[model samples]
Target: MGFRKGISILTISAAFALALSGCTSDKPAPSASTAPTASSSPSDSGEGGTDAKLEALGLDSNLKFKETRKITVEVYDRGNDGGTKPEDNFYTTYIKEGMLRDHNVEVTFVPVPRWTETEVINNYLAANQAPDVSLTYSYPTIQTYANMGGILDLAPILAENKELFPDMFEYLTETNIYWDQDPATGTLWALEGRLNVLNRINTFVRQDWLQKLNIEPPTNLQEFESMLRAFKDNASTLLGADADKMIPFSTSFDVGWRADHLTTSFMPNDLTDKDIYVNGFDDRLFLMPNYKEGIRTLNKWYNEGLVWKDFPLYPAGDTTEDNLMKLGHVGAFMHNWDYPYRNGDDSIHASLQRLVGPDAAYVAVESFPNDAGVYKKFLSGPIDRKVFFPATNKEPIASLLYVNWISKFENRVFLQFGEEGVTHEKLPDGSLKTIATTGEKIMNSPANIDYTITSNGINLGDPDLTVKSIANGYAGVDSKLIEIAHKITTNDGRIGKNANVGQIKAEDGQGQALKEKRDTILNKAVVAAVDKFDEIYDSGMKDYLNSGGQAIIDERKAAWEKTYGTETMLK
Candidate 1:
């Protein structure tokens, strides 16, 4: 924040004036360092000192090590699994012992509560104590950090070390790849940790509840509503007689309320066949006409007692199931397709199975018909959450190597499956037969998934690894549930028409500010009467534009036209 880029006070003043005068450069402003040299592969570089060793391995030049160094990183401790304790967690220990320690780089994973992740991260960033590698799903936060010089510029580092990260580079730069860029210069600055499977975005329903209520799974909107009512009516008998506990369509206002698939019928944006996830770069929400309709549906469900009553009061990271499902009260949930089976003995499936019997059942509602009878909804490519190194990091090189370690195939296999024979026995057929308590499905977890560092990102390279994760989940006696979930996700999932091509302009820096303004207005609208939706939206949009929303949208529209031309992208 104190000008590490070395621009003098006078130059800063000139830039500030230009910024205030509403002039933005078409390109990114220059940074302190020059572009870095590239390496074809790890073997292409010289060897000697720690710096030379990194170069020899095709790592970033900035990643230099001398003797033993301890590097601090942040990880999300969701408190869902006791074995996932951050300080001594299996994944953290794997990084420390399996990878970082050999290089004399000790890793201390700082635990940030998963529920308060964003707020906690912002606080650490403000104090300059944030992790060397950090992640967030919000692009606005990344832009704000880059503008304040809070994050390290990794474009040159990533470019130079491409050989060390072939899968990552290809996944990001390939035809349909997705990655973030510097708003000012449009250079790559951050890296994304991607999801291995696209099957996470479908609907999960309690099939046992349906059977008990003698109702078939809902096919369309009206039947879906009818199912919710049936769940509500039969709640006491099937889900224990707790009047306040029974929730038909469980969801949290903080996160789950607007899950793309849940509101696919609303068609949140006219920009595409699917929903345009604000990207946090475009800050264009109230402008989307059908967006309010999505909120209106939630409000209608809330007033009718279909959704969780205290949902609005829940904290950001607390999803609907966090409040109800694990307690065996939720009848239906629209979340990760594998929600029921996660968390082992403490998992949703385990708890629900305890109440019913060993033959607990869940079925995937493959594709829900929207009002127009379409199954299209927003689903991102491999990666959705992205990670970056902040400028305040003590050792950038160690961080990069740490990333490289996780990105490697063998290391990731260890983390994903645990110490092979100990946690898993490698089958001769090349598929994994998970060990009782230590495998991914039971006890092990991929490291730093919250920070966009994972085995998941690199798992795409091998067919063995590709099928292993699903095998871990599907290894159960009944593969029917997992198969149906996979079919629904791969078959009906949607992506943005131009997901990868959009540029982040300089004006996008105002997104965070406008987002805060919009959130205040949005809260009022979501709880408002259906008829009052437009009035609340107008009030919010008015404040947003007055406070710089118009500038952001204007620049974004210009950038859109410049990229695709007006003939393709309309106003």
Candidate 2:
């Protein structure tokens, strides 16, 4: 593609070079004009001249094309509970009307299945029918497409029009926007979306069960296991006639994900930045030092009837485990920071309260500890999803403008909260309280993240406000519990170190397949007999290393060494 006007040939080449280089800085490139601040929340009518107002803040006023330019943006079709069509809902209509009015752009949303986004996006890319703007959690997919010349290099466009995307740059900041710039060729295939929420997983136990049994919350690994054993040994007392249905600790087939808090706690405290970056491909840290012993602990629990035995039968989306939790049969689980409080009145905690009692609820606790006796959570970096454009995009600038529009606080707040009284309510405290809605006004995804493509988590204008507002999201749950859960989840959290030594080309086209193999290895090892756990785990790991895992490790190590030249860590 040719460079846009105002970006000279020298600028384009330099931008390209920066794109291919590793993410070496956390600052945004200098722009011609200062970025703009968001206006007060849009009026209820949503009738303001958005472009005129935005341009008044020093953004480029020349965004209006000579004629209406049509572009498609991808949205996740979660098939959420409310029965709203992801591509044709009230939010979509609002976006369409606003974009068309503001910039003379005809916007269309193409829905990709949330469960199979990577596979579907790849298919669309191969068919040359990918949306102009799209997103995915798989950076390697974008890298693979860029290597094949199927993706657009956005470095020049972003560099030249930094003034146009003032709000986008403001929220994403320099750190996330340029996080994936390659170190070698300087080609930016994608822009990393800002992950506003950094809360990771925490272990949750049945507080009511603990109270009924007169047991206090576990303080460490030994106490944690003792609690589970107590649950198993006293199932009849806890469940009455349904004692046989009790599951002391339950997890799913994706053991690595479900048991991450436990496994991560076992990771050594002294792993270098190079060690983290090189072996972080597994995402679960399954390959990290001492991870095997963590899984071994689970295996021992499994053989002793303290852990769920049917986890291997359930796949990624299976509801068996969730049903168990809702039925009040699961005594404990390690999952997302707010796992129990999600889904408002329909959440697992709510269901437990209805079926069991008002006091029955899952409460967050810190139990597992690393060898150093600390709960160390390996958190994701500030980046979340990767947003990019395909080569077939007819209006890259319009697409950028579209994202910029959504990144504005007014537009994002409205889209996220949806006409106040209908989908949410303005609390007396000046924070939004999300509410239940029906038909077209329902939010299919949390905070409408599927629609707000460039930003994730809550961004309610202030960091403290954003965090305080998070607890208010769970409609029926006590905000205090959510507040406590959030605190526990983020405590002792460490963002995994990444050298950003450009793309590990060996990782291209290998992520999904290797992930399946990873699940296989962990599943078999976690279910093996206690005496045979090491043998099974070692064999599975050997097979995994042979199947492209080693290639990734080798490439990552080589890339890190080449970038820093024997410096094990980047300061």
Query: lDDT tens string, model 1, 243-270?
Result: 5678887665443223446555565334
Candidate 2, residue 367: how far the Cα is off, in Å: 0.4
Cα lDDT over the full model 1 = 0.57
Root-mean-square deviation of every model = 7.6, 6.8
Task: Kindly list the per-residue Cα lDDT of model 2 for residues 302-408, writing each as its tens digit.
Answer: 99898888999976556678889999999999998888887666679888899998899899999988888888888998888899988777566678888888888
The parts of candidate 1 lying over 4 Å away from their true place are 1-66, 100-102, 158-178, 182-186, 235-240, 243-245, 255-259, 268-287, 317-323, 425-429, 433-460, 474-477, 497-550, 567-571
TM-score of each: 0.77, 0.89
Ten-residue region with minimum lDDT total, candidate 1: 1-10
